[model samples]
Target chain A: MLKINGKPADAAGLTVAEYLARENFDARKVAVEINEEIVPKKNFAEVVLRDGDIVEIIGLMGGG
Target chain B: MVTLEDKFTLGGHEFTSRFILGSGKYSMRLIEAAVRDAGAQIITLAVRRANTREHENIIDYIPKGVTLLPNTSGARNASEAVRIARLARELGCGNFVKIEIMRDSKYLLPDNSETVKATEILAKENFIVLPYMYPDLNIARDLVNAGAAAVMPLASPIGSNRGLATRDFIQILIDEIDLPIIVDAGIGRPSQACEVMEMGAAAVMANTALATAGDLPLMAAAFRQAIEAGRKAYLSGLGRVLSRGAAASDPLTGFLHD
Candidate 1:
């Protein structure tokens, strides 16, 4: 049970890359953070999502 | 004569256009047109939770060669602002971050102290910090001491389109602060932008003015012309005003009737 974007998810053994692919998120368009630390794009394939880990996926938006 | 060589340097980048456009409250399709019409070299953007449902992204619309200035609009404290800034950088936009820490949701006024703190931290990390702050002299001084690249003072509440309610204080920052004074927020019209430029502001940033206009691209062009006109006026030096008596521009000694 991992918290991805404040919601509980059942992804306990998936790598960050797998989670992003499953969720249909373009890895290039979004930045990933696990438990308040940024996960660089190169490490997405190796970093695994553990239970209780918090994930935040952010992207650029219209702003002033 | 003002030449093309006249430019303002921000965070080691030189910009000839003094109008900074905001890419909010409007359609993404209009961004390119607005940027072209406004002649803006720098534009502002926000970072947020990526929408899984939508495939379109704002970055897809921005034209090439324009610099991105991402803001921390949702952060309520220094740490939160720092996190947002780091995330914005991770997105590969650039190192420029506009520190906008706001605790109040109503007026959306920036928290100056938190902004100062964020500026200090981000500047230390090599981020070109541009803190949007309420018009206060002491805080502007503090931000300069905190290693800010520029000080953005609001003319009024954000998105209000009230137009330069904080004129005198903004003028103070322009007069005293060594860094570039980019007037942001509540500038409703091209005239207001021109007024600030004439007051020696390094640049003018607006979003709601164009967003709410009947024609966004046209208004953006108007703002561009007004900013350029005002910059030229400032550079050429404004004419003096009369104190008590009227000064005639024509020769009084040799009138046509006389």
Candidate 2:
């Protein structure tokens, strides 16, 4: 599968677990919104990757 | 007339100050200095799922002798909020949970429906749920029914610094809701925090106003003095918004000249 993180799409056949294992995303502090709605935390590693899906993850900043 | 040493009590916690400080945004030294200078006993910190070292590492700054208040500021729904609250209990550091359900990012508006749901679940778990809600009287009442320790209504959108933007709604909350009402957000300055306290809010939480200052300690001390002044003013009870009554130096209209 082809995937894009933040910007460019790259050739990716890695499972969700493998990808997350490879990446350094603050999984506990980050919330992923796919196509505008949120993805459940439990499914972060279960859902396989696909091409052209917009995924945005937000984390807590050091503010009020 | 009320006195200066009056204590503010809610959910069985008694705090001497009318201000609540946030444990986010500032450095440990800054936070420590400001908190100590401000005499803030109640502090609000957020709980997130990420490992402490990776995300906002606020746990290290939990000051001694101050009550730790954990808020679910990032949780999108009731379930996530509940899970966070439970984790706090398991950690055995803080049983008090501050619930904030922000479904949107642009306005950071409170999702009243999901907040109520989370409050109910967390409260049932015997957690002292202090929910951050919109300044809605109806929802405040609902949260009280759900066993919330207190109701924290935003005076304005989070981090707006607009200052008491929901004054009228807040007054309504004070009138109708039995729970202690704490103005939680959009307070950008010491004066703003004071004004909210003077309006009879049990407490106010300030973050940006303190963290963004050129000198965080001085700003925090200013807020401390302001909060005390406001609390005192609230206790003394202002006679009217605007009314000038002159004291009798000799006599008023003695001869009725007019």
Model 2, residue A2: what's the lDDT? Answer: 44
Please identify model 1 stretches exceeding 4 Å from their true place: B253-256
Total backbone clashes of candidate 2, pairs 3 or more residues apart or in separate chains: 2
> Which window of ten consecutive residues has the lowest lDDT sum in model 1 chain B?
B249-258
Q: Model 2 lDDT vs. the true structure? A: 0.74
TM-score of chain A by itself in each prediction:
0.96, 0.67
Give Cα distance to truth, residue B180, candidate 1, Å.
Answer: 0.2
B37-71, model 1: which lDDT tens digit per residue? Answer: 99999999999998789889999999999999999
TM-score of 1: 0.98
Q: Candidate 1, what DockQ?
A: 0.91
lDDT of 2 at B17: 84
Measured over all alpha carbons after superposition, the RMSD of each candidate to the real structure, in angstroms, is 1.0, 6.9
